[model samples]
Target: MGFLDGIRASKSQSNNKSKPPNNHFVAKDIVFNVDYLEKRFSDCSDIVFRKIKSNHKTNKDTIVLVFTDGLVEGMSINDGIIKQINLYSQIYNSKKINIDLLQNLLLVNEINRSNNFDEIIENILSGNTALFLEGSDEALILNTRGWESRAVEESSVESVIRGSKDAFVENIRTNTALIRRKLKDPNLKVKDLKVGSRSNTSIAVVYIGDITNQQLLNYVVNKLEEIEIDGIFDSGYIEQLLEENTYSLFPQMQVTERPDKVCANLLEGRMAILVDGSPDALILPIGFIQLFQSPGDYYERLVFANFVRLIRFFGFIIATTFPAIYVAITTFHQEILPTDFVLDIAKSRVEVPFPPIIEVLLMEGTIELLREASDRLPIKIGQTIGIVGAIVIGDAAVRANIVSPTMVVVIAITVIGSYIFPHFSTSYTMRFIRIPMILMAATFGAFGIIITWTWLIYHLCSLNSFGFAYLSPFAPSNLVDMKDAAIRAPLFGLKTRPIPTPKGKKSRK
Candidate 1:
């Protein structure tokens, strides 16, 4: 069956099941609201409901403050809210205590009225205090989110010697505040979105309202809204779901932990997706070259930055093609090598039992295994394992004649080159691309390597990230945008934003 047909069948099957009864009870009397909430939270041991009573001459009223224990600050509820209410009740005489009067009398900064029981529950669960009063039909939600979270620290992944030290934390509001701290423009917009049906994960889309393309904004929003999932644990999950090409090995979005990086992209007319509980944010409509750009590029001198960028590009080429080229040249095109080099290689391999392809595969697999092992182990032990494994294994292989020393050097260079990439996802993609190239080279020599390169370039050119060309400024050949592609030009030299931006809005000025 087709994709749409399958979806229809699933919908029909789901329709057959009885729909869940709506639990959205509106707050009316205090007794009914408290009883319903207590019943709903019967299993929750951390739920706290504090009752406060106020007596004025002939009238007596009760207020219940509901919040999740350990999720809220006790001082805020007691000193800031309850204490002030009690003081006001003793000093003033009132027969009716309305939400407006309570809000004005309270010392809290944030207060909103809501009658929906679902909203009240959600607020309480999200570290907010809900105040339900006797004889009142509305509940007030106070912002008391004081949950423990890691303090902002320098990002280990995207570290820069001269850049801002503060990185995004898991808290969504704190992430937004970091971005706002950098870009104080009124046009900076933060739109909240809730994804994941069961998790109800909070996601924020941050962009400069005036500069961001409306079409791109709409596209991102619609795509996010279309997502139907059980939960979203990280920004990575959202990245995968929102990417235009899921089957491609190349990443369609850029994931970053630095708020400065996100702000820079937003200024460039790009939009950022920040998911709650994820330090990393996803940047969209990103070109392939962007994967090589570092956050430090803008901090250093233009010449030095451009030089580093060129080195990264060189490393990318070497990482992806070195193994395949070495295999093809030594195995099939031996005549292309100098006589001395050829003799030396032959002498080295004389003691080896496996062919060029087999030697390459075996060494590559061993290196990959060691690399993965190191990554999975503890930090100190992982480093030790990688060093010891590489030195000991490479030396043992050479002594055993299972692989040549020269082959080991080539593979070493390939692995080291892959590490030069700024983005981990790009490095991973390079690793994946190398395997296919290696296989093709083993089968068809240098011609196979060329064929693989051609196919890779074609695939990259064909892909798009949110309608912007993936291999942009190269395949489409935008000379203006090329200034920042392989090598970045001076900051002042960049007069216009990247291509595919809203028409007439391309100029950065």
Candidate 2:
């Protein structure tokens, strides 16, 4: 059979099987519940089940506390719950203990009551203690979550000279608290949702209810609800699924580690998504120009920030087109260069064996390897490795006549230009586009470069992020929004939010 036919047959067979129904009803009998739970968690050694028996005035009562081994707080379980229960039994002389009065016995701050067995199991897995009484069908979920996590430290990737040093940690609650501490408005809302069928990862969607567009909010929430993945390890997974176009290389969502950045975006009527295990939070409805912006832009003086913004734009152009332009000029349009420069380039290439395209590809590939090595290595050693590898490789290549010295310079400048991008993803996207640009330049020279650029521009114009145009203020030509696009207008001069905001809510007041 053909490959397609085999795939179809396999899918059909898989679809024909009868799926088992979920048996998650809570039983009134504690013994039956315990047996079911024991059977469900038979092979799991980390799940702890502690049973306590209380005898008060000839009446015997039993309670089972379920929690994960290292996830729950030790003191909360030992002293707060167990010790308190024993103390209450000894002090209060009652024949029958009421299940409703159990809340007063436990010393926990946050206690919730639920009768769903599935919810009880979920709470236990999420580092909470679940108490199942002998007579009652309900279970009490205690907030006993306590796990070791890295402390909030300064962001390494998006470091700023003059700004808050605190960055988001892996814990979702801590990340939300960081943003809450910044934006104290009552309208700021945080809604929780669960994604990933197997992983059951918790995600928080945060936004200001007063200023945000209701339709945009609904779009984001619906998109998140539609995710049917088995596991979501990081925010990147949700970002990809939430994208309007999965095939596009450009990211529709902006991921940031800084709480300040998230707060700024939220204040502007954008939504922020925080996943439980990822420090990176995603900001939705982002435009292309916003990706080039840095949190430090608003922190610095307007004049200096504007100058830096201009430099970044220039770097973007150079990183994307410098190598391609050089290849097209040297191979197809040598007459464009001055007499001295042309003679110098020709002299450099005299001993080289490969053509311009091969030379460019080889050098670019070597630089990429060095970058990956540097990134993967230890901090101190990575810097040393990057410097040594570049010097040794470039010098050796020129000496061996494997590539021209001019080509080495062009590749080095291209790498530097790519690094100037504040966002690593944007830098990566630029790096990826270079390959096609190089191939086009090698095949059709100047014409190919022009056509490739025109196609890229058209694609950008057509793209959207959460129903908002990706290249807003440039494609649709909104002059009012351009104040913060390519240039950094003074803080006082800027009074309105950018494009794609809620209707009748344009001013930043």
Candidate 3:
């Protein structure tokens, strides 16, 4: 009780932190301001500080430019900004330095003046050059944000047979542009946000204005505002924070790199979050069935799409429970198997010393290790390792009698079935839970598998992502949403948008 009380006290103290103090306004002394900025940015080698004068001998006052070195364009600062400032100062040397006068003189497109020191520092760090004058208490922010970024290409992870080849880039503006290209309607709105008090990373909350529920928008906005953290480097961070059940193993938000996928979700009254440094966007209020969806599902013929969707649905099931079923039947439910099949399995296991569950685990662990290794290796080498390594290792294990031939076949099918889902997160969840299901099956035969699935169903039905049921249109049994869940019921059949959009209004396009 004493330790628990201490923990409670710590939590209370953390929650009672005072609001941050207001930032001091920029001072009129150029040297003093430069010294202060340099002190704040101490040890940061990339910070560039330059001072220029209109006439070195004539004017006693000078202008100071502060920015991050690589983040800004040297050409833009030299030709566009610095040249114009100098040209203006020489022509009007008698004129006093002021925010208004300098604003008219600068040749920059995105310019703003701020007296707050915090804003100035933020602009400089964000790749904009900050201009400070000798006699003015305000700084001019000249936007010259630029840096080499990965070129947008078809997402290697979420690849499709048919769909847009372009994916979201790490840069937020570039990603927003991709979304804009897909959604040209005036109703499409993007709200710029800042998270992570220390990192101050930019986030773009995108939604379709008129079509999206206002209440849902407000809830999402409020949730974002409530976040207080040191840094948010990826959309995954935001996804974890936004989740109502942080303890749940299942991903509460859908992550996608394709901009078209974001646009489609937006049209359905759902909101998306795009973080600055992350290429993936978070699609909220995701249902379990939504995890099975692919962007290509809607691009192909109805027959083809449904056929593929069915394969994925069944494949996921087989991947998740096939090994467990095998273990349960061979260990305790052998009477349920045919005599020929039992004989084949018994014959295969004659040379093997381990039980069915142990055999499955050994094979599964080896496959998982190989999969993880391939992911961490270089692309070309990774593919070779995944294919060649699996074949070589499986063959060696079978011959060495480390595992039975039948067990090897079961594990192989399970691995292949798990690969059907386009969403890697969902695939990972299946892999994560498979071992537990196998353990339970080994203990309770088929009863254990039944118990595990029943609990999963109940837990899924109980869960919601921002108030949108995880097992939507299934547990709640909404016929309207069922058309798009497991089956791609013709494009025309999906006439209505998602009714529930993560605490959003029910009405949608």
- C-alpha TM-scores of all predictions: 0.93, 0.93, 0.91
Which residue pairs show collisions in model 1?
Answer: none
lDDT of 3 by residue, 376-448 (tens): 9999999999999999999999999999888888898998888889877788888877888999999999999
Instruction: Encode model 2's per-residue lDDT on 325-388: one tens digit a residue.
Output: 9999999999999999999999999989899999999999999999999999999999999999
Weakest ten-residue segment in model 3 by summed lDDT: 2-11
The residue ranges of model 1 lying beyond 4 angstroms of the native Cα positions read 1-23, 56-60, 93-96, 506-509
Query: What is the TM-score (0 to 1) of candidate 1?
Result: 0.93
Model 3 misplaced regions, further than 4 Å: 1-23, 89-98, 501-509
Separate clash counts for every candidate: 0, 0, 0
For all candidates in order, the CA lDDT equals 0.85, 0.86, 0.84
Per-residue lDDT of 1-509 in model 1, one digit per residue for the tens?
A: 84223333544554343322444654445555776788989999999888776554532366788999988988888888989888878776565677778888787779998988987888898899999876677899998878899999988777777878889899999999999998899999999998988788899999989889998899899989999999999999998888878899999899899988888889889999999999999998898989998888888998898898899989998899998998998889999999999999999999898989999999989999999999999999999999999999999999999999999999999998998877666788988899999999999999999999999999999999988899988989988889888888888887788875665565431
RMSD of candidate 2 to the truth, in angstroms, is: 9.4
